[model samples]
Target: MRRLADASAPERRKWYARGAFFHAEDLHYLKFLIGEGARVLELGCGTGELLAALRPRYGVGVDFSAGMIGEAHKAHPHLTFLVGDIEDEAFIRQLPGPFDVILVVDTLGAVDDCQGMFENLHALCARETRLIVGYFSHLWYPALKAAETLGLKMPQPAQNILSPADVGSLVALADFEAVKSERRLLLPARVFGLGRLFNRFIAPLPLVSSLCLRHYTVCRSLRHRSADVRSASIVVPARNERGNIEPAVQRIPRFVEDLEIVFVEGHSQDGTWAEIERVRAVYPHYDIKAVKQPGKGKSDAVFAGFEVARGDVLIILDADLTVPPEQMPKFWEAIRSGKGEFVNGSRLVYPLEVQAMRFLNLIANKIFSILFTWLLSQRFTDTLCGSKALRRSDYARLKAARGYFGEFDPFGDFELIFGASKLGLKAVEIPIRYASRTYGQTQISRFRHGVMLLRMVVFAFLRIKAM
Candidate 1:
């Protein structure tokens, strides 16, 4: 650490410029992980370049090297910079915290005690705060060493060379849960047109992404402060599922203080709306409400129900009842216990019941799952699952960002998934047993819908990946 302080600004600038392409990739990825106007604190923020680019409402940068801090303060006057060691608990205790985002980019490998750093960061985080750690992949150590020896890269002291799993374990020991992890920057150096193609398309693929130059992990504190005790509102968007309405109302379990059921009936040819009213009448003890959707798609109905929902947690349950309402407790428990911020149902993990899903639809689901997992940089086994859960506040944030994807999603799944990813919410997939519907014909047109899904995939690429 003392050696870093001894280095001059010009020498550091030359060294950093040698890996300009790599730094650019890191900046782009970090911007995506953090939202606008967030209060951000960056550890080891050399020159404060990345912090300044984020345009944070409140930004504080800390580095042990006095030279680096001086350069950062000079370069980024808008942000606060101080020379302090993160490993020093006394110094960390003095810093104002509870930041929205805490960044430790490219500094974990240089730390003497990774767990101690995380523990100190824990004190600076709230329940909603996210800690993003970026480190070089140990697999690239030999190549990096060779580049340094040839003067193509900056020379550095011996690094700890920690793997993603090692960091994850350390995070857990420090009372933080790992939310998401990804590998990036497959083409570290610029190569004209080829670099964009490889990094944007080829490098994100499963087998190829493992060989990327850098790895990032996003984590959150394990303490359940805001969601310790909450109520729930289950929103069921029904099109032509009159037969299952009563059973859904009866089977939905209660795991919170109060549970309200909101059924948004789409324009169904059958008496689905009447059935919803009848169920409310039959179960007068249950807090149930029904509304007719003025629009066409399930997405419209979902938004309508959410508008009237009055609970701490909001949930989406399909009217077809393929995913049993009995599983609602698991979703509630997950968010309430702080296991995940966005809970998505995954039907692919378990064996499906007979005729649960048609062969063609199943195949399409599997294909889209893989494509979406790659696009979102998050593992999603069942992208079309209807049973999803999240906090009401989180849903409000997603609603505000809906214009990014526009009103294109008819199934209502991708909109939430994309929004959650954009907000950097921790998405957790809960495995559920899928069953065949007992009543009403299937509404999906396999061929037409499949084509629309393909178009959505392309849209995702343009919006999410191409950027």
Candidate 2:
């Protein structure tokens, strides 16, 4: 412990001397996971620069080095700094707890017992608390060692050299589940014009991203207890889905608790609005509401229905009925089990019904899935699937942060998925068989929409991946 403290004593000044590109990049990614005004506690916090930058409502930083803690106090008096070993259970218990976000940046390697550090973190976290850990990638071991030898980086004590999988196992052992993980910072030092472009754009690409400098893991407490059955709202966005309205109303299964069906009719040449009214009257026993969409696009229509929905859980179901309404129970069950915070339906997992999707559309879906998996740092098999479910509270946060991507998404799928990723929410895909539509023609224009989707991908790269 004395040797560890001595090694990190000069780090605060050394970090500023050596261009802090990795530090800046790490803070950028962490800020996305932890929104503004969160209660944050950072372990092994050296100088507390990252904690100060996050602007948490309440911030506490702990370091094994008394010198580091003293420098942190002098640098950022607004936040509390303490000298304590994170692996010590008694020391961890003394710190203020129930933090919304707990950060461990690059210091896990220096810890004596990595698993003990994770176990101690549990005392500071709540059910909703998120634990974010960032560490140097073993792939960059030679480069980092060379930098340290050349005095370009601060010298450190011998590291535990844990991989992302190792850290994940330790977190699971400590009663937390891994939500998401990714590699970042391909260029740790500025290289003039190419630095921003390479690190932000090129580094996040599928095959290329694996060679980055650091790995970050986001984890949440494992909920062994089941969630209670809550009221639900299913929002159906109709734009030429007149023929499926009555069938949709009849097919939707009853929920254990309250269930309301909301129909948002967009501008359609067919009498979709009339069909919605007809279904509402026919299914008077069921809770149903109809409204004319004030704006264009499926995103606008979905938002309109969601605005009027009154349920604890909110869901989006395309009126085409390609994903059967019967699958709602499976989605509800996943959320009710506390297995996932965001439930996405995957059509690509199971074999699709004949003529359910065009060959070109199928290929496009597969391609986009690969792109999004890299972009969002989460496994996404089908990004265009029209069925998705989430808690109303989560939707509100997503809606508030929608401006980050702007109103570019017409499909409404990307907005939800992107927002969930930004919030570090656990997204689980529910596999469902895709069936051929029995009613109206497909509203999607294959070539035109495909081009738009490609543009959205680039937009996401700039907004999400590059960030």
After superposition of all CA atoms, the RMSD between model 2 and the true structure is 2.3
Per-residue accuracy of model 1 over 48-88 as CA lDDT, tens digit each: 88889899999999988888888887788988998988899
| Model 1 worst lDDT run, 10 consecutive residues | 1-10
CA lDDT, every prediction?
0.86, 0.85
RMSD of each: 2.5, 2.3
Residue pairs with backbone overlap in model 1: none
Determine the C-alpha RMSD for candidate 1 after optimal superposition of all C-alphas: 2.5
On a 0 to 1 TM-score scale, where does candidate 1 land against the true structure? 0.91
TM-score of each: 0.91, 0.92
Candidate 2 positional error at 446, Å: 2.2
Off by over 4 Å in 1: 10-18, 149-151, 224-226, 281-284, 349-351, 374-378, 461-467
- What would the per-residue lDDT of candidate 2 be over residues 1-467, giving only the tens digit for each residue? 55666567656667655667767777787887888998999988888888999999999999878888888888899999998888899999888898989998878887877777787777777656888988888878888888889988876656777778888898888878899888788888788866667888778777787898878899987743245547999999999999999999889999755999999999888999888888888879999999999999888998898899988788888999999999998888888888988999999988889999999998999999999987887899999999999888778988888888877777888988988888888889999999999989988877887888888898988888887
